[model samples]
Target chain A: MSQFKYRADTEGMLNTYLDWYKQAEYILSLKPSLPDKFKTSKGAREYHRPQHIIICGLGGSGIAGDLVKDALGNEIKVPIEIVKEYTLPSYAGEETLVIAVSYSGNTEETLSCYVEAVEKNCMIASISSGGYLKKFSEKTGALHIDLMSGYQPRASLPQLLFAILKTLETLKIVSGQPYAEVIQVLRENKTNFSPENEQNKAKELAEKLYRKIPVIYGHSFYKGVAIRLKNEFNENTKIPAKAEVFPELDHNDIVGWEDNELSKNFTAIILRNEEEYMKERIEATIDIMKKYGAEVIELSSRAETVLAKIMDICHLGGLASIYLALLYGRDPALIEPISLLKKRLGEKVGLQKKLLEKLSKTVSQ
Target chain B: MSQFKYRADTEGMLNTYLDWYKQAEYILSLKPSLPDKFKTSKGAREYHRPQHIIICGLGGSGIAGDLVKDALGNEIKVPIEIVKEYTLPSYAGEETLVIAVSYSGNTEETLSCYVEAVEKNCMIASISSGGYLKKFSEKTGALHIDLMSGYQPRASLPQLLFAILKTLETLKIVSGQPYAEVIQVLRENKTNFSPENEQNKAKELAEKLYRKIPVIYGHSFYKGVAIRLKNEFNENTKIPAKAEVFPELDHNDIVGWEDNELSKNFTAIILRNEEEYMKERIEATIDIMKKYGAEVIELSSRAETVLAKIMDICHLGGLASIYLALLYGRDPALIEPISLLKKRLGEKVGLQKKLLEKLSKTVSQ
Candidate 1:
């Protein structure tokens, strides 16, 4: 829409935007392997079967739990609840499995919940590049999955998702290696969205989405993808976007589009898959939104399997968000406000030193 | 901000707007009674203990599940997952409690999920006024809690919430009477927000929220209220609004506010309760939003218990939405577009007759 044009070079002013595209390949190329700490631990084998599972993390790190919940929710025997709060649920006790995920391992909410989980004597695991979570895990002999460093947590989706799936397998809650199939699907499909292709659908969609609020919609399993895309739009494009899961959206949010003024600013991006049971309802909702003057864009998943379809759309959404950031002359990678908040928060509470001391004592034992 | 003024009379042009307020009082006066069908059924007593619970409904009916999940999530022995889709989770089996809620009982999505739950052999229960759901329940001999008719599903929050809580009590998932305290809180606080009260905080907040997008923020237990408030603002005011939970909001959405163009159109309403565990983080999020030029309005909950506080805020939020609707010169009750969609949908699918025929046969048997 603007004067922005597609560039073949990986570095297009913002390295982060380019890195997002490359990360899809990284995710695709990844081998399904668990970290030794998580796989080879006596504690991992000795742990009791939890009646419930609570995954604690926030933002990019936290969203992994959502993906797992949607993707493998029905497959797992126990209930898995995602907690993005500072405190653990009261039921998170000996019978609960607590997975603390933070890319930098310093997320205060995750750390706080981890502490609470430990006090409640819940089985614990940790996933992070490196930070207090790693140190704490080492001290407490908790199963830890060390992710590769130097990427934003949002950019670290592959590692986050892989680790979560691996944890599920290790717990014996789900059988077989599901992550491998997802990787294969990602590998086979990476070329479909390469920037070299002049007709890249993600790029085209991003161009259409320029200068408008993108409302992502999905149903059932795709609900996780909708949320993921909304997060990418916020963090990568720095745009105010929203995600609505269907049937729910059909009820209340569809009416909000009646306001002609606000409707003008939104472009509804509906994620469609043949697997969606309520396709007719989604269509009706799109019709209502379009009739009220909102732009509607439908992106259908091409993958055959449920997991593959989710990954395929997630890759497309990531690329689209990067393209949008480039169009707006934004860095895509820079989140100054979030960094500032984290910094100010650290200064206000200064929990890092206290956590280190606590962990060091545990490590000595 | 507008020429709209508060009036003592319940007839505020829109009967639905007046009805919502009256319904709050009606809820207060409710004796917390479950229908004989739900309480005394041999079928209800014969059901086995479910390892997990899945509540299936959409829109207003679906939100009841969320309220139960938030209020009693910690207390419940098993995990409860709310499904707002046409399909049931794969894990839903004999060991799953499937509570199907649909006010109109003809909601296609709910019916669809009900069918799936039946196929999965999930322990089923139904809550609705009357329609296909009622007929189906009678046919299947499932526990049914029939609600009084003639109100919008969203306006029927009290009945929906109470029936859900009552069902939980009957299942022995929760001990003692939980609804009584909430009803007491609602009765005592109803006068504080009466349309005649010139200094009513909800009305004042609604006035400030006029002609702007409302971004509601709450923490932990208050998250459900934030979502409910957002739904009310959308359906009742016919305006676009957003809800974000604290700690999670701090991680990503607060940065999205930095976009000056998008920030200009939003009024941030932060729901504060004395019991909020992450007060510091919530305050930080508010500061960041305000620093980016978004108008910040804080509404504090006054009730003592968690359930009471949630209900207290929900009641206040309902009044605010109605007030905002009056200000916009929009009728709070008319959902003509939804009705039109439903009519068109029925014509397209010809489902009404088929569902009736199927259920009628079951009812007769």
Candidate 2:
């Protein structure tokens, strides 16, 4: 029953926009309740012997693969490579396991990768709400997990991410239900950041980020979280923000801070969690940011495990982005420009198909 | 005789400031005349077969691995993974080839990766001008390639990229000298963008990007080129520019442009080559950018091969950064902020070492 202040005209335009906050609760509930059907699915068994696993997805759906790559990279027996492009790596073949993830089941890049994997004799699995990917997966007898419909792909991170982890467990590549504890932690920690509480960390962070562009920094361990946060700020807040990994940013971006005019417009957020070797380097980078006149905010992780830390900050980032959108007196769910771009792209595809058909007809005549 | 118009105070401070322009020519001439000793170095012969190649580096040095990963990704038999972290992937082992590249031979991440590789029993090779990496490689009997000293790592793309390719050749992973033709093309095309010529495309482009943040877009084939250009602009021009690959940008960034205030301040440059599948998507994205009131400049590659195209645009981007700096009456070589940051980091490291030594002494007593 709690709502933040916003313009009357903009406030109620998107009725279900606030449901994004429910995703963490939904995901945590699914940890114990994720059907046995999905865990022990035939697709997991079919791809169990793969020498390498290739997860093909794009944008929001694609980022789940990145989270897996960062969180369970060293822990996984086989390499889990995220292919954001249309083509699979050359090493992808009979022994490769390809998971096509498209929340809408219509992402072109994921579809192209799926077709390429099929051509290369790779075992295929799919995760989608319901679209071309699901249809194709079912037709080909590949394992397919249907995500809950009606949510944006970015908002369904928990479901998409769990699907990947559960698949890994089923294949015996990783041991135990690794995400179960993290889910419980998220469920317990959810109420601490409710919008009604002025002490909410996410709202406080969002207040600091208003009217400024964010330059997020993180070490390699949680670089994916930074990336996810950057994406959320861009799509959810409709703000231009960028994320750069540490040590890498030091080599080049430090020079840009010399121009106070540009530096002052940026809010640098440093995300740290159990970073060992690069901890001192990150501290130095923060000192340089502050000295350069840019506002610096450091978010340190207090979670017991790396996965917990990653998920925690990621949850906080999602909340911050949404809160920032509300604070700016803008509707959080209206992505008019993205819809326009996609519509135009669809039209172009339609024209291309028509032209190809006409050319083929002329040839036939 | 070919001097740019700059304020008197900014002029003549660094005589060799424009040597970056001569890099392509230098790189080309070195192709045929490269020392036979370097061509058949002891390191090249020591580890001829690796099940997979892991390139460990950061920033400028790290980007070479990306170039190789993109350029020769499909051609190579084994996977070429770029590690910009302190730890190696779990799959890395005795059969893994770890190429640690630190231009100054002291990049902390590369050194950490080198140490981690040694611990994991992975075959290691070191590339640097000189530092701890060289000394360690020598002591451990690993292959070490001492680079020509006294140049920023960012300006040594030709040498770094070629070293990776030559190593690939030595391992029989790729056939024919792939870089020789690209070098020739670069040398022949260098004069078209001479600083003295007012008709220089680089200078013209730099003028358009003078007061605006550049949002660079490129397909998967040329994403590395876009990244290199972003680095050049950030370091040489001291401007904050962002680079996002096509298909990926279409996913989220299109929404950020809805804010006309922010959109009008950005200049979107699309870097294109022989893109097949995503060409329509990119064109549509450009249309969306234009509709959003942002200036869109399409930079099409004119070179014959992929490598040549990459080098050509990268060359142009470097020139544009320098030209923009000169136009702004600023010194291109003044990296005072980066130097200050490095000094701070060094102090931190020294203090840590002293503390550890003191702690050990106390324990021994």
Candidate 3:
């Protein structure tokens, strides 16, 4: 009977998403981020020796850093900690390396935490552009690598993520060469991954999963993608989703699907990269899931490098979720109620102001 | 105009749940489970040699094996694999040790897999009540440990779980004393954590979260608890909930909280124990969740053994979910669709008849 509040018609909504993609394309156009930007010498010496790496940020920007720690934790000799609070853990000390990330450089939470990291005398690094975070890093002499930010934070995942990984390599936690090559591979293969007909597994998935909740699953190293898919659906399409890993899921969650009634409204998207072949447990798992009414989408990784294959698919999944939102005729940008809730919480607790000196430091056994 | 199909009337439905609990109690009473009911000390002595272990089962039973792997993974020298399907991994060799678990030995998937483990020449052991599983184990000359049944498989979690721990100890992978103490502590502490009123965090959590989705977060060792909580809710109340660990959630999922619409319907419950205090990262991350729209319910472990704490809260959470289902006027006992889905699936894909074989084993470098 009437035009929609956000879009005039179906065609208009599609165009709006196109516009969203165009805005993101400009940011992604920027060159090799992080280590390329920092160009640190191969063996740039010296360190106060950080025992804990505290990452402070939220949403998309924070997740990339969190993922790096998760995948690399078993490999990394030191503990990689992700600090999500405005206040520091009581363990904060001078030995901590606190990396404050904000793609917009204006994210309030990241800025609030940056000040705390400074107060605690922890090593601080900023990943952002033209905001309070950028200004604070410049004024305070903290290591600030300007993030190319024209797109939404969710879209600018690679640039922000690259900085965190490069920082880790700079710190001698792991090598960055393979990870850096991943970014190039991801960019090199975008057009092939588009939602053009049935060729796009990401888009085909979005179509098949039009109305159902997604129960995404992945394995050890690439767990980040599953987390990414769940939130992308939640934030972009306003659809519900959750993810779990294996062979751990086999132990308990398999029994859950038995004698349950939720089979109709859910789908399991198993992220099956080249490495999926490594897990014998997964075949049994996939077989078990097939027994349920659940539809399993076998997702394969692309590109030559693991990093490239991971990012390309994860980002495509992000776009697929946005398209799903368009299909549902919902606004992808507005999150007003959550903002209101945060405002209410802020007044009631004064939580941010109360914990201004927060930093997290790691201790030895 | 008529009435809700399954859930009819709220108060009357609760009577049904109480009746199910009563039935479960009667089942437990009549069975009087013994850990050593079908144990063969000679068989156990013969079955322990191996370079690696694969624990096979589903749901609560599967998770117990996984929990041991997660908690003691670094502490134990050999890697443990958890299998949920009706087959084994391709890497099974003469050195492989397999533990087959099925609370009800009639459980189809485990039986399918148990048969395969036999063909693969895996040193095998069985954990179940009298059923096809025990019969198969006897015929196949495999070691077997019979557990008391009648409580829902989800309810008899401790029996399936702890027996595996004891089995592992008998294999010389661990000291048997810690687990025995854990069981003793659990037996002594079940009084306060049982149903109805006064200091029952699970009951309180359920009442508060009657119409909300529970997002349970846990630490490394206790992530299994969060998994258990989600499964318990599924099998007991037929509700959909999700779980993730701390540092992991901080990465990407925090963005899902940025929803204006979904936030109203979602509630996050965090699972914490001693790890919360030791892992400052978890504490900081939980603080961030508090800032967001998350309704935090911190469940602390009673100062006993890990087994006691897990069993105590899990039983309480199970009761609460069933009660909540009753409060919503839903039938807690009917898992019709899930059962039907399995039947339909068995017929649809020629999966049941497919030759179950071993898949490639992951060689973690």
Which one wins on TM-score?
Answer: 1
Model 1 lDDT per residue over A34-81, tens place: 334321112332466788889999999998889878787567766778
- Give one digit per residue, the lDDT tens place, for model 3 in B150-194: 545665666676667656666666764344444444444344434
DockQ of each candidate's interface versus the true one?
0.56, 0.57, 0.12
Per-prediction RMSD in angstroms? 4.1, 6.1, 10.1
**lDDT score of residue B88 within candidate 3:** 63
Query: For model 1, how big is the iRMS in angstroms?
Result: 1.9
The list of candidate 3 runs beyond 4 A from truth reads A1-189, A192-214, A217-228, A231-240, A244-315, A321-365, B1-49, B70-75, B86-91, B177-201, B275-279, B345-365
Better of 1 and 3 by DockQ: 1
Q: After TM-score superposition, what is the CA distance of residue B286 in candidate 1 from its true location, in Å?
A: 1.3
